[model samples]
Target: MTAKLEKTLGAVSLWGIAVGLVISGEYFGWSYGWGISGTLGFLVTTIIVAAMYTCFIFSFTELTTAIPHAGGPFAYSRRAFGEKGGLIAGLATLIEFVFAPPAIAMAIGAYLNVQYPDLDPKIAAVGAYIVFMTLNILGVKLAAMFELCVTILAVIELLVFMGVVAPGFAISNFVANGWAGSNEFSFGTLSAIFAAIPFAIWFFLAIEGAAMAAEEAKDPQRTIPKAYIAGILTLVVLALGVMIFAGGAGDWSKLSGINDPLPQAMKMVVGHNSNWLHMLVWIGLFGLIASFHGIILGYSRQFFALSRAGYLPKSLSTLSRFKTPHRAILAGGVIGIIAIFSDGVVNLQGMSLTAAMITIAVFGAIVMYIMSMLSLFKLRRSEPNLNRTYRAPFYPIVPGIALVLAVLCLIAMVWFNQVITLIFLAMMFVGYVYFSMTKHQRENAEEDLMLVGDNH
Candidate 1:
């Protein structure tokens, strides 16, 4: 069975899905970097990361346009490197798309708690999963429509948040003990930058998720490229705007290391118990929900793609009456829910489960980035005559830069997020082992079902 993702997403809807998948990163996650490197230092790292994402997105567009498959990187790497490479790419996509929701769910819970302070965050998170997963199962069209609605509202919310915090934005407040919190750079400061890299990357982590929906997109060749490019630029600008304003609003450290970073920044201007603060917190839920919902859509398609190709149980590839990947959606939701309560994240040693999950998700993203870029180069050389509607502009240079930055990002994560990275590697190893043992089973697949893209 092939992935039956409804091709209801046009370029605008695709933009919404792409930006929606990552807007929460703007609203949360990145603030954790402030605790690591302070404002000035994180700003430096964010600039470098924005540059990397710009390059990566541009290079990745070619793959999405040329292949136009729901499997995204799995399709790219599978065609280029066969089963072993396909497993690595597909598993990493799973980690990136699957693990991210729990983190976003935690942020959703945190945002609700900021507003009410009585509702348990975990309860709210589970409720979010229930609500969004139901919507996802109902239909892909409805899900994409909802994605467009919330994504627009979330963008407006961020702009309004920046407006509310703008008057408090001061250069002096921003630089106060900003450089590694010591007012000077040291070896420790350099270490902090490395630690801060993942959070910096969080600003645009899942924007590439739009590519995962290529099979469900209208005119995938044209719409996918436009959506990916538009989505990345939008994220880069908004990330900078929110980070700069939020950091300058007041004692930025007060907002550091928190899941509800936007609300914390709002409280600096409006007071802790201000009505505006409460409203801001309420509005923040849309950002979190947009990502939570959008990524659920992403991971399901990926799961469908893998299962359809025999990397997973083919049963998961079956579509529901509504034609959405219902079983796959539910499977991913179950995994994320379990992750919320999972204290047994082995190799994190003593790391907080939330931190470990986020780090693992980022690790997955880095791996896909490297593997996908390599797939791009390999395809260019190996399949020179393959059909192509678009080619990466800078060829070797753009992808070359994205590749080097991806490796650097991986090294940074390994150096700083040791236990979490270890946990991620352990998961990958287990997946490879399972794939190894199932090698005979994989070989029995029909040649027709082995083809990439949604055409099967």
Candidate 2:
């Protein structure tokens, strides 16, 4: 039977996908994790990280506009590097997404527990996970619609919190008492920033969602670049607002002890009324669910792409009636179920932080992105005749600056969180072995099946 064509998504829908980045647990975790360093420090650090995020998005947007395929980083790496390169990119993405859902689910559980002190956190997490997984299996069109709605609500919630909280400005919490429970700056503050980098990135990583859906994007070359710019700009605006709101609400020094720093800022303006906190919690819950939905959808496409390229089970590459990669969606659900147990590894905050570290370990994605950006220069030299639509402004200089910033972020994440960094590396090594063994076995099986068919 002929395969059904996949539906194309518009630029506005893609922007919704981009905005989903802000509601993630990583964003909250970063604000909380670094809130210890005072508001000014958080602002300074976020600017550096945001700059890196912007460059990464631009480089990725250039590639997506150039190759507009379903594979996201998998397609880019495959084209630029080859099968092995593609496999690594695909594997790193799997690791990243595998850890993401549970982190979000667990965060929901944590917040819910605070609201309903009697509720079991584990139960809350499991229920949210099941709900999110169901939403994903239903397919992308539905998921995008959900994303569009949640993105709007979440953005409005962010702005409301900022506006409400901004008026309660106390210059006290803005000072430097150190967010950490330490005495001096020494290597500790630097170490905390390193630890913070991975989770900090979680808020910014899915700007490539539009790219992953490139094959299903109407006029992808035009739509994808537009989505990238819009998405990144949206993130920058919200992120900057978050920093400003957090800074203005109270003294930066006192922010160190607050775990849910955003909500804490919200409370300063709205007061400690249970009704107000409940409303904010519900909004936060929406943010968590929306983030999980986007992560699963984006990563499943990467899984489908890898399988099509022979790096994963061919079943995962199979499409359903809706042209969705149903098998990959199922595989991701199973992996996510197991990853949910990582919540058992620690409380909500620890799992979220660990997931973030695993995410940045995709130095491979950054590496591939840098190569793709450099390839822009090479392609200009080699394939000047290739059709050009939207070129990254400033050409070599923009990409060059982006490459340097990405390198710095990677180094910083690695230096501070060497343990989690090693965990991420270990996971990648396991993926390499699995890829090698599976590829060899599949090739041998195919040969045997062909021989038997011929003999018959």
lDDT string for model 2 (147-217, tens) is: 88988888877776676776776655543454344434556666565555554565565566556777777
lDDT score, candidate 2: 0.64
Best by TM-score: 1
Alpha-carbon error at 205 in model 1, in Å? Answer: 1.2
Model 1 lDDT per residue over 66-127, tens place: 88888889989998888888899999989999999998998898888876789988888888
Question: How many steric overlaps are in each model, in order?
Answer: 0, 7
lDDT of 2 at 351: 40
Tell me the lDDT of model 1 at 192: 85
The TM-score of predicted model 1 comes to 0.96
Candidate 2: give the clashing pairs: 36-179, 172-251, 173-251, 173-252, 173-253, 174-251, 174-252
